[model samples]
Target: MKFFNEESDFFGLTKLKERFYSSDHDGLSEADREYINRIKGQNPFGIISMFIGGVSFAFGPIYVAFPIITIIFCFLTCGTFDREKEDNPWTFIIGFCLALIGLFMYLRGVVHELIV
Candidate 1:
């Protein structure tokens, strides 16, 4: 009935002793540990946003709004990350760019039709 096990890495692939008590992990303070645990407990919104953005690319010009919306979601999700010192922001940036490309392609088709 133990809620917090010192022997458990909270289900992370590495053992708790190896992950939290090892030399490489020794630099983590209590606040850092709490922050990591809190982040691990949250839903993965960035991945979900990327997935939705990727799926939106398939519907084409008729559903132009979907990609646009996905781009906004990507930006919003990306903004939550610590961009100055981390590589994770690139993932969201790439997703946002894909969504933007899809949106532009969709608009290009409409513009061509109107011009012709």
Candidate 2:
């Protein structure tokens, strides 16, 4: 069986499913390919963290737990950039920064409330 993980810009769908594809799709056995394809398709937590981290900033004053959740997701993912393969997996970094910012804002608000 042949599998392809070639990067392509197709109908804006690539952006949505970018995590599903990777450079190391070749040379794997049929079972491994199928396993990665159907079961462990992608590390979705990074993308989930990115979205929630972005929203967490707005929710900083209201939902303090959101930033915490986002931070946890970022740490759990193997999000380092694979320079050997030239892959830029940036979702974790972006999510981490956003989550930190959100958390800081939340703490600042609480401190302000206490002071006032």
Candidate 3:
């Protein structure tokens, strides 16, 4: 199924696929493009997600909020990085995995607490 019509771009949330989103990259070299995208800075959500994921993995037994927040930040990181330069949001991906592990640990701690 179809959730949204073809005429709409999910309320402009989805972008139409193209070679390049901006005309600035049309005549530039690969190095230039990379430089510009880098100057734009990394995705904040991704950075935060990674940091929080680490914290959750370390202290998940203390609180449930950490993993939940990390998961949210990981998903929110989509489309924040430049794809044209072959940039991968590995930080967010790793964060997502770490958060899942943290969540598992959290559940284990909860079970252990209950058993004791």
Candidate 1 C-alpha lDDT tens digits along 1-116: 13223212244312422333334547889998767644532224456666776666555355788888887666544544433323365556566766776688787874224323
lDDT per residue for candidate 3 within 1-116, as digits (tens), equals 13333322444433532223445568889998878766534445467678888887766656778888878656654554555444468877888888888789888765235433
Full-model lDDT for every candidate: 0.55, 0.60, 0.63
- Could you tell me the TM-score of candidate 2? 0.51
Best by TM-score: 3
Candidate 2 residue 100 C-alpha distance from true site, Å = 0.7
Give per-model TM-scores. Answer: 0.50, 0.51, 0.55
User: Model 2, range 1-116, lDDT digits (tens) per residue?
Assistant: 01112222323333544654555767889898776556532245456667887877667556789888877656544332233433345766787888788799887765235333
Model 1: which ten-residue window has the lowest total lDDT? 1-10
Ranking by TM-score: 3, 2, 1
Q: How far is candidate 1 from the true structure (C-alpha RMSD, Å)?
A: 11.8
Most lDDT-accurate candidate: 3
Residue ranges of candidate 3 with Cα displaced over 4 Å: 1-41, 110-116
